[model samples]
Target: MVLISWYLMLPPPVFPPVKDASGDYKMNTTAPISQWIKFKTFKSEDSCKARLKKMPAFYKCIASYDTALKPAATPSTSTVSGAAGSHMQ
Candidate 1:
């Protein structure tokens, strides 16, 4: 069986507050929602969630989905999909 890797997504820096469709103001993030970076890697979704629980308060994490592994015969594939966006120092 094939295995899919998960990512601990890190949110980009916040800028000014922006209004959404509902007319509620929210902190404007540096990157767009789709472009938010994937910070760390995990073997599975459950493991990613586990680490997020213990992560520092400063960081925000989101689980990554590997759509590449899925049965997508289409030719168009996102370069950033199913892969880590940033490297650790």
Candidate 2:
């Protein structure tokens, strides 16, 4: 079996209250989600693969954020479709 480890750290920052679709102060992109980051260590390539397969939610959450802090959406349909296809698969 493969073995891997994970760690999550939230930076010490106060996030402003942001309104969601329901008009409630909830944590979303407008909040300090960037304060939260994940650090992972893999024993080997196989271990990383196993972790990704077994814990897709964790993988998705960690990979969903953009390092550049740019808007996640683009103004092009083709680019959006390509990105969507890559993520959905």
Candidate 3:
């Protein structure tokens, strides 16, 4: 599942921006969550929630983001490294 598009790069506003605003200045020109590059890959999860309900509302559909991003998934095996010196005395 993947249907992401809400990153907001910035540097292209000012189309009557904010004087009588309807929508602009996306949280003050977003782009700083490590330069968020939103994904977009759909082959399932009901076609990524059926195109995430016609987009908008920070479109999102995650299946663990299609895997392979393990920053941390700990189960606390004593934090793993060496593991009590590999179970030796």
Best by TM-score: 1
The predictions' CA RMSDs to the true structure, in order, are: 14.2, 13.5, 11.0
Instruction: Evaluate residue 39 in candidate 1 and report its C-alpha lDDT on the 0 to 100 scale.
Output: 76
Please, what are the lDDT tens digits per residue for candidate 1 over residues 1-89?
66567777655554565666887554334444455566788887787888888975544444445442234355434544533344322
Cα RMSD, model 3: 11.0
lDDT of 2 by residue, 1-89 (tens): 53334333223223565665887454333334454544454445555555666652323223333353233544899888999999997
Residue pairs with backbone overlap in model 1 = none
lDDT assessment of candidate 2: 0.46
26 in model 3: Cα distance from truth in Å? 1.5
Q: Write the per-residue lDDT of candidate 3 for residues 1-89, one digit (tens) a residue.
A: 54642322223333455543654354323432332334565556777677667765554465544342224354776657568777875
Off by over 4 Å in 2: 1-36, 57-89
* Cα deviation of 85, candidate 3, in Å: 26
Model 3 per-residue lDDT at 54: 74
